[model samples]
Target: MTRRIEQGVERGSRITIFVDGAPVAAFAGETLATALIASGRIAFRRDGRAALRGLFCNMGTCSECFVQTAVPGRAPRRLRACLTPVADGMAIETGAGPDG
Candidate 1:
């Protein structure tokens, strides 16, 4: 299970983001990877070879944390979970499926 840093630090406003139809609690200004990791979802996607991929180079140089996201009326798009900030109502899918 993924765990959050217990620094006893105050966080920004909390928001809900959907991951594979399940709701995950996230704080504003935090990256999707951070939220996922805190929520015990370490694997962001699976490669063509079926290898699980998660955060690697967090500075966007590597695309290991890519995830598919979709909003109402808009086509699904891919973004790096480590670089993309979490937004309220964001829908994400993680895996080597048609959506991701």
Candidate 2:
């Protein structure tokens, strides 16, 4: 099931992004956190105790939505998925990050 409400919201152009080497469909203008949650992902990262973490604030304040992302020419780095927009061909790795 998808978390996105398709009733009133107009969908953007379809784009594909890789999450943990798996393909996930998303809209062009949506945030990585949006796409990930819409794709039925529950855990964004693992805490020090191996507990799962997911989107909390949905904003940039809490760092619960952290993930590692890498583009064509960019090195993999930890980023707040809620603040980063999804891009075509963007690769994401969940259950990871500096905190995990």
Candidate 3:
């Protein structure tokens, strides 16, 4: 499991969420789902059935963590938020990608 230091985040500090086009700001140290939820992003991705889904199992197992992450120099990729660490300047989208 990944360790989180909530108090480590500075007061009023924010991180950017790149959802397709707009850049949204959320508090640092929050999970992709938590951060998005705080930003009013209720949907994290689409299931194989095209059903909207969000964080379910907080642990690293389960399909609930699926998210498409855009990394520098790499193509957009589907990843598990429960297993990924949020970094500054990350571009994330919810929904099935090539890997999903």
Candidate 4:
């Protein structure tokens, strides 16, 4: 199920979470923030200085939209929530800055 956002596929459905070594259910078609917020898992990211940040802008351009995804055959990578479409079993990690 997708929300009508001016001809854009912007919504998701119920899904799951992989954070801090645990699995949680997340809403499909929902942004990571939307799902996390619904599940009260809102510490979306940590800044370079280790400051916590959540979905501030809710758009693809913000650094706060970062999420780590478990891509098959490739190393895990950071994806922007505002731009990525959520999958049924997508694994996401929250509140960690990129490794230096």
Candidate 5:
């Protein structure tokens, strides 16, 4: 049961980002990895071996958290979830990578 802690920390404006076509609530400044983890979506994508992978070395050094993201009129790209910030109406595709 993973959840975001909203105890005493100040957060940015609440927003929504789509993950695999499903709406995920997030804050304006939160990293995609943070929001996805809080949503209990551990597997960001599948590796070439077909194994599920999530955030590892979350500071963006490791490539374990790649996911596809799309912006209007732009080609979807594989991005490191840990380094990408969440934006309102942003769309993410999980487990839809080349080997996924």
Candidate 6:
């Protein structure tokens, strides 16, 4: 099971988001990477070589956590999962690039 920090810090309100068409529980003010990690989902994407990639820098410097996201009436765009905040009704698709 994935474990989160338990230093008694209060988290924001809980919300639901979709990852690869699956519902995931997340809290407001939490980054997409954090929410995915908390939900035991570490593999955010796969490279062209078929290598699974996930959070690395935890910041926006690295592109390891890139994921394709789509919102209602909007075209899909690629963004770093670690830098994007988790929002209600957000839909994310992982491993969207060319398959190996």
Model number with the top lDDT: 5
Candidate 3 per-residue lDDT over residues 18-71, each given as its tens digit: 764458665666667666655566577887889778778878777686888766
**Cα distance off (Å), candidate 1, residue 85:** 0.7
As for candidate 3, its clashing pairs are 45-95
**Candidate 4 residue spans exceeding 4 A from truth:** 1-14, 71-73, 96-100
Candidate 5 wrongly placed segments (more than 4 Å): 71-74, 96-100
Query: Which residue pairs collide in model 6, if any?
Result: none
lDDT of 1 at 34: 92
TM-score for each of the candidates: 0.84, 0.84, 0.68, 0.66, 0.87, 0.85
**Local accuracy of candidate 4 as per-residue lDDT tens digits, 1-100:** 4232437555455466665446766666666666656555667777788877777777777677687776567787887766675566677777554431
- Give the per-residue Cα lDDT of candidate 6 at 84: 93
List the lowest-lDDT window of 10 residues for candidate 6.
Answer: 91-100
Candidate 2 shows a clash count of: 0
- Determine the C-alpha RMSD for candidate 5 after optimal superposition of all C-alphas: 3.0
Q: Write the per-residue lDDT of candidate 1 for residues 1-100, one digit (tens) a residue.
A: 5376659878789899999888999999999989988987778888898888888888898998999886777877889998899999989888645433
Local error of candidate 4 at residue 98 (angstroms)? 18
lDDT of 4 at 19: 58
**Which pairs in model 4 have colliding backbones?**
11-29, 12-28, 12-29, 12-30, 13-27, 13-28, 13-29, 14-27, 14-28, 15-26
RMSD of 4: 6.7
Residue 11 lDDT, candidate 1, scale 0-100: 79
Residue-level lDDT tens digits of model 6 in 60-97: 99899998886768888988988999898888988644
